[model samples]
Target: MESPDHPLAAQCLQTLPKIELHRHLEGSLRISTLRQIARQHNLPFPSNADLPALVQIQAGEPLTFANFLSKFQPLRQFYQSPQIITRVVEEVIADAAADQVRHLELRFTPAALARAQGFPLNEVMDWVIESARRAASQRGLSLALIASFNRHEPLELARQVTALSADRAGSGIDGLDLAGNEAEFSALPFAGLLREAKQSGLRLTIHAGEWGGAANVREAIQDLNADRIGHGVRVLEDSSATALARERQITFEVCVTSNVQSGVCPSVLAHPIRGMLAAGLNATFNTDDPSISNIDLTHEYRLAVQELQLTLAQLKDRVLAAARASFLPPAKRQTLCDSLEIELAQQIST
Candidate 1:
C-alpha cells in the first residue's frame, strides 16, 4: 500500500542495494498469510473479526500508538505450528530479498512465538533460528537474527532470551534486542543482563528515544551499552544525549515512517532523522515493520529523498554506513561492505 510514484523519484532506488537493521518479525506478518493460516488451522477468533483491519493499519485509521499496536493483537494467534513459523520466516526473508536488501538484521520475539502455543521458549528459538538460516540461504540474502525481548515482560524471561542468544551467538542468532513498550516500561531493569550479553559477544541494540525521551537515549547509550539505537529519532532533544551519541559514534537504526505512523512523530515531513544525522550521529535508514506500516525499504528510501530532502548520494552513504554498523564480525563485515560497494558502483554507473 506504500506504493509511491512521485515525479522526482526517477532514480531506480529499488534496484539499489540496501541494509535494514530494525525490522520486526511479529510486525511483518502478511495479512493474507494470517487469514490463510487461521482458516487452514481453524483457529479461534471473534466471529466479527475484521482480520485485515485488525492486523493492518487501515486507510484513514487513527495514527495513534494504540491503533498502531492493535495490528499485533490478531497476529499473535497465527503462530500455531512449526511449519507455520517456518513459512512466515521464509516469507519475511523472501520479501526483503525482493526489495533488494543486501543485508538484513531481523529481530523476532522468542517469547511472543512461544506464548502462542505454550511452546517451549528454547524450542521456539530453535524454530526461528533454523527457519531464518534456511530461508536466508535459499534467498541468497545475507540475514542475521536478533533475539528480541519485551521490556514489559518479566526480567527472568528476558534473561532466558538473552542466555539463549548468547548460547548460540555465531551459529544462528547474531544480536540481542530490547523491544516493546518503552513509554510504560523502563529499560533500567535489564541493564546488567544486557551488558553481560554484550560481553558474551552478542551485539546489543536497544529500542529507545522513540516512545521515550532523550534521557532514555542517554541511558541506552551509557547503561545498556547499545551497539545501535533503534528508532532513535528523539535523541536530538537533549544536547547531552546528542553529544554522548556523537562521542560514542553509536549507530542509530532510524525507521522514519514507522515513527510517524506509530505517533512517535507527527508526520514524516516533521521526523527528526535529518536532525539526528546533522548532529554528527551515526544514522542509517530502516523499515521497522514494513507489513504493519504498509511499507517497504524502498518506500523508506523514496521518502528520504522526497520528504526528508536527502539526496541520492547521501542515501548511498547511509547504506554503506548501515553495512559497517551491521552485527557481522569485523572480517565478514568488511567482505559485505566490499561486495556492496561494488554493486552500488555498478548500479550508479549504469
Candidate 2:
C-alpha cells in the first residue's frame, strides 16, 4: 500500500506550478466519477470494483496500442448526457488544479463525446467550454481547450470538427489537435484541412512519431504547419527530422509513461526524452492520458528526475519550456512564462 503522506520528492514535485499542453479530456476522467456515472445511468458494465480494469491500464495487462485504446471503449458509455459531460469537464479541471497544474490546454474529441448519445457537436463543445470556464474560474487556473480530430475517422467528420473549432476559437477554444491511430491511418488525407484550421486562427498540434516514424514529425512541421508536435519522441530516429525540429524550434510534447505504456518505447528508462532534450529539441513533459495511465503532471516530473536522471535545475527548465510552448497568444504566453519564472525561482531558493 502507498503511504498516507507523500514522499519528499513527491511533495517537492507537487509544489511546482506546472503546465500541461497535451492532456486529453476523454482520457482524464476520474475512476470514482466513472463509477458513479455507471451506477447512476445503469450502464452495462461490472461493479465499481471491476471498473478500473476496464478503463485503466493494469499492472499485468499487455501494454499494447490495442489494449490501451480498448480502455476508451468502456469510457464512451459514460458520456450519456449533457449534465454528465459538464460534470466530467468540471471534475477534470478540479483534478488538474489539485495536481498543481497552473495552466492547461485540454484536448477533447467531439466525436467521442457526442457519438455516445448522439448529442450535436456544437452543444457538446458548448458544454465543455462552459464547464471548463466555470471550473477554471472557481479554482484560479488558466484553462484552454483544443479540439481533436482522429486520423482513423472520416474526413467529413474531421471537416465538421474543424469548422466547429474555428467558429468557436475566440470563445475558449485555443487550438486544433490531430490525435488517433497513427500506425494504420495516414495523416496525409487531412493535411489540407489542418492547414486550413491553422489559417482560420486556430493553433495546430499533430500527434505524430509515436506509432508512426520520425518522417511523420517532418510532415507535421512542413505540411500540416503544426505549432507543436505531440509525442514526437521518435524524431531522433532521423537526423534530418531532428535538425528540422531544431531549426523550426518546434516544441515536442513528451509524455514519457504514455509512450512506454503504448509500446512506443521499451521502458521508462529507455524513453528518448533525455535524447530529445540533449539534441536541443524543445521537449516538455506532459501526462497525455492522466487517468487512463494513472498519472498526473507531477508524476511525470518526478519520473523525469528518478527514472530519466534529470537534475532539478533541468526539470525546472523543462517546466518553463512547457509554458513558453503553450498555445496561448503571444502576450498571454509571455505573461504565463514570466509568472512561472518568478514562482520557480522562489521554489528553488527555498
Candidate 3:
C-alpha cells in the first residue's frame, strides 16, 4: 500500500534496515491471527473483528481517546493465554519483518495478563522471552523486551515487577517501565523501584505526557530519571520540558497514528513528531497498538510521509534514532548500524 514512486515511501519500502524502538507485543497482533485464535480457542469473536477490513473512518475525523481505548478490550481477551501471547510475539516480529525492521524493543505489562491467567510474572516473561528468541533466530531481526508496571496497579506491585526484572537481569529482560493511564498515577512513589532496576543494570523508560501534561514528562525525567519516553508528545507544550529532553538527548518513541487515535493529538499532521525532530530531540516512530488501530510498521512509516511530509534522510535518521535506543548490546548495535548503512547504499545504487 506504499507508493514507491513517492521518494520518502520508496526509501522506506526498499528494505532499508529499521529499528522499532517502541511497540507493545499484545497490541501488534495480526487481526486475522486474532480471529484464528478466537476460533481455535472457541471464543465468540467480535463482529468488527476482521483485521483486514477497513475500519469505518470516522466521518470528518479520527478516534477519540475513550472510543479508541474501547477497541482494546476484545483484543485483550486474546492475550490471556501463554500460547496466545507467544504467538502474538512471533507474529509481531514477522509483521515487522515485512517493513524490513532489523531490530525492535517490545514493551508490555506482563503482570496484567499473568494475574488474569493465574500465572506468575516470571513465567509469563519467560514465555515471551523464549518466543522473542525463537522469532529473532527465524526472522534475523534483533529483539528486546521491556517489562512495564501498570501505573493503575498499587505502587507495591510496581516495585515487585521491577524487582522481578532485576532478578532476571542475566536473562533476556532489558529494561523496566511505568505505563498505563498516567492520569491515574503519580511518578513519585515508583522512584525506588526504578532505582532498583537501574542499580541492577536494567534501563528505564516510562509513559508520560500522553494523557497527562508536560509537567508529567518533567516529573518522569527529573524524578524517575527515565532513559526514554513512550509518548511524551505533550512536552512540546512547555519550553522547559522540551529543552530538557533535547539537552539530555532523551529519545521519545513517537507513535503518530496511536496519538491521533487516542486523541492525544487531533490529527496526524498535529503530531509533534517532526517538531520534536526539528527541535533536536531524538524521535522514533512506532505502532503502539497495531491491531486495535489496524496499522503496521509500513502504515506508520507512510503516515510519517503522507501526513508529516518527512524526507528520505529524515526517515532514515528516525530509524537510526530507534537503533540507538534499542536494548541490544553495544556490539550488536554497531553491527546493525553498519548493516543499515550498507543496505541503504545498495538500495541507492540500484
Candidate 4:
C-alpha cells in the first residue's frame, strides 16, 4: 500500500516520542511472519498471496464487526508452540520501537494463546512475561504486560487469569483487561473479579462504549472500577456518562482507524475524539490492532492532525495523558510522565 500524502505531518509525528496504552499481541503479528509460520507448520494455505485477505481488512470487504473479528480465527492457528509465541512477542516490541513508541502496554488473551495447542495457562503466562521482559530490555523501551480476559468466556477462566495476573503483579504482568464482543456479552458478570483484582494491586481497563452504548461505559467506571477505558468514544451518547467520566477523570484510549474499520464510527473524520476533548474528558490516541488496521502510532497521530483537525499542542497533550494513565507503579509512572513532558516540550517548540 502507498503511503498517505502528508509529508510534514507524518515526519513530525514519527519523530515525536509516544506512548501506546492499547495494543493487542494477537493482532500485531506481521504477515510475513505468518506466512513463514504457515509454510513451516504446513498449514492449509494455497499461497502467500491469500494470507493478507484472510488476516487483514481489505478495501472491498464489508467493514462490519464480524468481518473485523474473522481475521483472528486464522491467527489462532499460528500459536502452535512456545518458540513461535516468543518470536511474536519480540517482533511486537521491535515494531513499537520502530514506530517511536517509547512506552507500550501490550495486552494479550491467554485463552487465545493456550487454546490452540492446549498449553497450560500458567505456562503461557510465564513465557509471555519472560519474553516481554527480554525484548523490552534489548529494545530500550518501557514495556508492561496486561493479561486480557474475554467477557464472553466463562467466569472460572476469568478468575484463573485474574489470580495469575495478581500473583505476578510486580514481576511482569501489571494490569487486567476485559475485552471481547461488547455488543453481545455484558461486562457485569466479571465486575466482582475485576474489583478483587484491583484490590490485589492490579490495574483495570475495560472495553466499553464501542460496540455497546454509553451505559456500558458507566458500568465500567462506576461498578467495574476501570482506571482507563479501551474505546469509550461513545460516552458522548449520554450526558450522565459524559459527566461521570469528567468528574472522575477517567482516561479513554481512542483508536481512530479501528473504530472506522469495525463500523463503530462512519468514517475516520467522524470519530468523537474531538468531542471527547471538548467535553474535558481525558482522551489518548492508540492503535488497538495496528497490523489488522494497517497502521502504526505515527499514522494514528498524523490522522488526528490532518483528518480530525487536532492541533499539534492537543496531540502532545494526548501523548502526555497516555503516559500518566499507564498502569505502572507510582514512582515509575511519575518518572515516565516527567521525562515525556520534557521531551514533548522540546518537540513542540521546534
Give all candidates' CA lDDT scores.
0.87, 0.90, 0.78, 0.92
Stretch of 10 with least lDDT, candidate 1: 1-10
Candidate 4 lDDT, tens digit per residue, 1-350?
Answer: 11334565567788989999999999999999999999999998659988899888999889889999998999999998999999999999999998889899999999999988999999999999999999999998998799999988898999999999989988889999999988899999998899889888889999999999999999999999899999998999999999999999999999999999999999988899999999999999999999998889998998888888877877888999999999888899999999998988876753
Which residue runs does candidate 1 get wrong by more than 4 Å?
Answer: 1-11, 45-49
The 10-residue segment of model 3 with minimum total lDDT is 50-59
Cα shift from native, residue 218, model 3 (Å)? 1.3
Q: What TM-score does prediction 1 earn?
A: 0.95
Cα-based TM-score, every candidate: 0.95, 0.97, 0.91, 0.97
Q: Model 2 TM-score?
A: 0.97
Clashing pairs in 3: none
Single out the weakest 10-residue window by summed lDDT for candidate 4.
1-10
lDDT of 3 by residue, 1-350 (tens): 33434775555554666678888775666667767776777666645444333322234444776676666556656666888878888888888887788888888778755764678878888888899889988998888888988777788788778878888775889998788778877777888888888889899888998999999988888888899998899998899999999898898988888888788898787788888888888888888877767677777877776678875566767777788787777888788888877776655332
Can you write out model 1's per-residue Cα lDDT over 232-312, one digit (the tens) per residue?
888888999999999999999999888888888998889988888888889999989889988999989988887888877
Error of 2 at 6 (Å): 13
TM-score between model 3 and native: 0.91
Worst 10 residues of 2 by lDDT: 1-10
Off by over 4 Å in 4: 1-6
Better of 2 and 4 by lDDT: 4
